[model samples]
Target: MRYEVWAPSASQVTLHADGRAYPMRREDGGWWRRAAPGTDGTRYGFALDDGPALPDPRARRLPDGPDGLAAVLDPTLSVWRHDWPGRPLPGAVLYELHVGTFTRTGTFEAAAEHLPHLAQLGVTHIELMPVCPFPGTHGWGYDGVAPWAVHEPYGGPGGLVRFVDAAHALGLGVVLDVVHNHLGPSGNHLPAFGPYFTDRHHTPWGAAVNLGEPEVRAYFTNSALAWLRDYRLDGLRLDAIHALTPRAPFLPELSSAVDELSQSLSRPLFLIAESDLNDPLTTTPRSSGGHGLHAQWNDDFHHALHTALTGESQGYYADFAADPAQALAKILRGGFFHDGTYSSFRNRPHGHPLNPSTTPPYRLLAYTQTHDQIGNRAQGDRLSAHLSPGLLACAAALTLCSPFTPMLFMGEEWGARTPWQYFTDHPDPALAEAVRTGRRREFAAHGWPSDAIPDPQSPETRLRSCLDWDEPKREPHARLLAWYRRLIALRRATPALTDPDWSYTALSTDDRTVHFRRGPVHLAVNLSPQPAALALGGTAAIVAAWSPVAPPDGAGVLHLPPETAAVLLAT
Candidate 1:
């Protein structure tokens, strides 16, 4: 076996393997390495200048958590049962889930048991929220320290292999949500090794990654490739790329490296980014002077639909509250409601315009709920707890019928009532207290009561966030699940609904309603408090509806009840 790590700041480095210390030889570019035959479960850590041993930055498995020794296990040794020829971005329905809260066991093997349920829900892709190892135990996963190690509490590296293999067997592709902006405040050992982070730019979490440094860039790029090659992951969702400051060459460079790996693997791979910039160039090809990513999460769509349904008008929601119908219509027509527009919330101009004719609709991933949108709230209430059943169905109809690709938060399909609150298990008392205080302060700014915020260190907080799997088999939950299944089935059956060509899509809006046409399918949603009417020419049939009345006669008019959405197929 061979062991290596990049630790430029250290003059002497040693490998601690199974209670034995061996001096390591320093190699070029701040790397230290040693080769020796070892068994599969060999435990090791690197010691610098006779100090405490630290886990490997690229450790594949941390059986004892982040602060303990890294275990040696080859990914190729895992047995795979299927040869999945990955799915494409267009017309794909993505389901996002967190392993810890996704199942009662909160392990990868247990999560794999639910893959068939997602497949039955008509999900083509499964997007797992960060599985990288963090401190203590459970977390939201964005605060991960070891970028390459799987969370041990959730079954580590072998468990991930099993999960991916099971997903492939079910005809579902897996997209991992990876955080590269900054490491968590506690248990992060990257700084002690070399210049992995820089003070040149600061993000909301902390100092930005040293992306401008060649070695730092190489480290991340290699990690990205390992997910595709070693773990057999189909794609990656880059978390909050907007926070990656000095993004000039790094974004493009990372995209290029992934594209190369995708070609080499002979499998379709995608790179989706969670970007707040609303810049179309994030998905534009590198040859055209852009980042060359496949798609990006469209928060504009979420905000528009969220405000329209809940009528909440705080913070960024204030922008969409004034006219949600207009906001929805703008995104449906041009892919961004705030494109080059004044944002009163930010007190400045935000975003740039996108050409509907040139831009592909699949480049944008639309959703009504996400981890940040729900979990970041003071009470962490899901839309299911707030919105009416009809309104929830209405939101689903619009999301599935939209031209862009669609993603659903873990329990959104069945309207699970569990709140995905921000929970952490930091072992350090000071760090844990700071997290609790910071969470309360942040929500207090949004006018939420500080007393309502859950304690981050409490085990009950983590347990409360787990999904109620039995909910989907009963009452309104069953009905909502049926509605989602029907909408996804319609999306797959209707060619017009899956078309990515934005030029083929059109939109119109009034004070209480919004209507759009994608190919031969027309969608009309009424956001008013009372029944509304819209004109539709020619012969059309109601393909799907939420509290919809009978289709109007040849008089070319349709009436919809309050908060209703309808999809019609034109003959």
Candidate 2:
């Protein structure tokens, strides 16, 4: 087999495979290559001059870990069972799943067993969190070091292939969450090979990825494409594109490449970015001087809904707490609340206004909770921990019924009580201590007792985060799960719920109630602690409700219980 690596800074390079070293000849563009006697499953690494062998930056399989030797994986060896016709983003209900805590086994094979549950839950796509190899056996995966390799603990590349094949067999599309912003602090050796990161810009993790360099840019773009192509993935959720420097060429360039590949594959593949910039340009066309991504996570929507449901106004939640009904109304009508408005959290004007008339509502995803919202909390408590089942159903109704694409974090359908906490298994003791201390310090600054913060390095933290599957079989949880199913079925049945045009969406807010309408469908939500009356524009039939909601009277007034939501079909 041929061995290749990009070591622009190295004077001499050697390929170590099967306990033998072969000198690699330098080629153009700072690449080194040599043919080695190896085949599938061959363990190999590259040595720079007198330095130790380092894993390939583009390694396909790291069997042991990120620091371990890279193993060759022949993509042709695995056979797919389904010839999927492809699922698009227009009407997709995305479910964000973390492989580590998704199942007790924390492996792709085990997670695949639960696909039937998601399929029956009416979600169209399963958005798997990053499976990239990090320093430990388990993590949130944002700290991944090997961008191209799958975590060995989570069934590696082969297991992912099998899982995707299984999902395809069930007519479900799989999208992966990928972190390209910054490599983890530990077990990262990219700097030893070449200048993969530049000091011109800095992110929360320090030096930004060097997108100015041609090869470095290609490195990221190619990695994304390879996942979509090789693994037959339907799409990717790009993590933190706002952190990437020179976003113009890099994002547009990636979108162009992905578009070309999608055409070649004759599939509906796409890129969804997690950006806080609130810039519509993130989803604009390249010809129109925009990045041209398919969709992005709408944290504004989550924040508004969270504050309205829980009335928690800490941190960024403060921006939406003053009048959550108005904030939610703005998001339902337009797309963002901080559209060039002052943000108390950032202490500055943040976000540009989105042209709702021009942009499709489906380009923005609506969710009540996500990994960051749940895991970053002091106790990693989910909404179920604080709110009653009626309110949980209300959140589900608003999100799944909104015109924007809807996404559900894992175990949310059944109101899973497991707290998705910040847990890591870094082998380095100092790094582990730093992570544990930092987590406690962050919550401590928020007035939480240091002892109240869970130890991130503890295995119990991860175990506590795992979904208790039995919850779905019990009371309130079972009822909430039924509500989720009914809401999704209603959305699937109603065209207005999945309508792409933002012009069709409108909302009106009262003191503690909101009446939202998209086309002929109306959603009335009462966030107050007491029962309230909401007036629909016209007489409507009650289609779905979290609590008992009477049909509108002659004046089109809907009586909704507090902390509940009801869907109405306008006549």
Candidate 3:
């Protein structure tokens, strides 16, 4: 087999395999190559001249974590079962999950056991958090070091293949979350090999990746393509594109490459980005002078819904709390609440206006709660812990009834009480200590007592975060699950609910009550502490209602209980 390593920073490179070193020929662009007698499962590392041996930059399998040698993996080894046609954006409902804590076993195969449950829950796609091998046994998967290696703790490469195959057999598409902004602090060896990162640009995590570099761009683009082609993944959820610097050609190039691959595969492959920039150009087509990404996480919609329900005004929630009704209205109608408006949290004018006619509503992924929203909190408490049952149902009604695509965090359907805290298992003592200290300090700034912050290095923290699994069958939990099922079923059956025509959508609010109209369907949510009533424009039938104190009267007047939400069909 011909082995190659990209070490533009080194003048001499060698391939070390099976206790033998072979001097490699340096080609243009600082790539070194050599032929070796190695098949699948061969352990190897690259040595720079007389320097210490380092794993491949694109190691596909790191059986012993990121600090060990790379294992050669053959992509054609796994057998695929189903011919998945892939789900489209308009009707897709995504369920985001972390494999490590998704089930009691925390392995890909163990997580696959629940695929039938998700399929039964009306989920069209299963979005797994980053599975790339990092320094730890378990984590949130954002701080991945080996971008190409399947996480060893989560059943490794073969396990992921099996999980994907199982999901396809159950008629569910898979989407992977990928981190390309920055590598983790531990087990990072890219700097020793090449200029994979740059000190010229700084991100919240650390030095931003050297995305403008041709070789570096190719590395990430290829990784994105491999997931879609090799793993048979239907889509990729790019983590935090707003963090990348010199983002012009890098974002567009990545999008163009993936689009090309999707066409070539004759399948519906998608590229979704998580961004805080609130810029419409992130999802705009490349032909129209935009990046051409298919979709983006609409945090504005999440914040608006969250603030309206929980009355949370801390941090970025302050922006949405200023006028939550208006914010929700803007997001539902135009896809952004702070479009070119002054943001007190950002301390500047944030976001660009999106033309409702040109931008599709499905390009925005709306959610009431996600890993970051729940896990980043001091206690990692879900909205169910704070809001009343009625309010929680209200939040769900707004999220599912909106024109944008809807996503639910794992265990969110039944309002799982487990705290999805940030936990890691870095073997290095110093790195682990740093993580523990940093988490405490970060939350302290948000007014949380240092002692109240959970230690991210604690194994108990991870253990406590596992889903109860029994919660879904209990009262209130079971009811919430049924509500979610009904919402999803209604969305599938009603053409108006699934329609992406934002122009046909309208929003109206009065005090604590907000009314949204999408085609023939109308959603009314009361955020007030007391009961409220709104006059229906015309005769309507109640499609769904939670904790409804009073139904529509003979005069076509709808009465809602405190923190209640109702879905009505225009008659």
Give the alpha-carbon lDDT of every model.
0.88, 0.91, 0.88
lDDT of 2 by residue, 69-135 (tens): 9998898897888898789999999999999999878999999999999999999999999999998
- Candidate that scores best on TM-score: 2
- Write model 3 residue lDDT over 126-200, tens digit each, in one string: 999999988868888887988888999898989999999999999899999999898888889999998888899
Give per-candidate clash totals: 0, 0, 0
Model 3: per-residue Cα lDDT at residue 324: 86
TM per model?
0.97, 0.98, 0.98
Go through the candidates in order and give the C-alpha RMSD of each one to the true structure. 1.4, 1.2, 1.4
lDDT of 2 at 436: 88
Model 2 global lDDT (CA atoms, 0 to 1):
0.91
Q: On a 0 to 100 scale, what is the lDDT of residue 118 in model 3?
A: 95
Model 1 gets an lDDT of 0.88
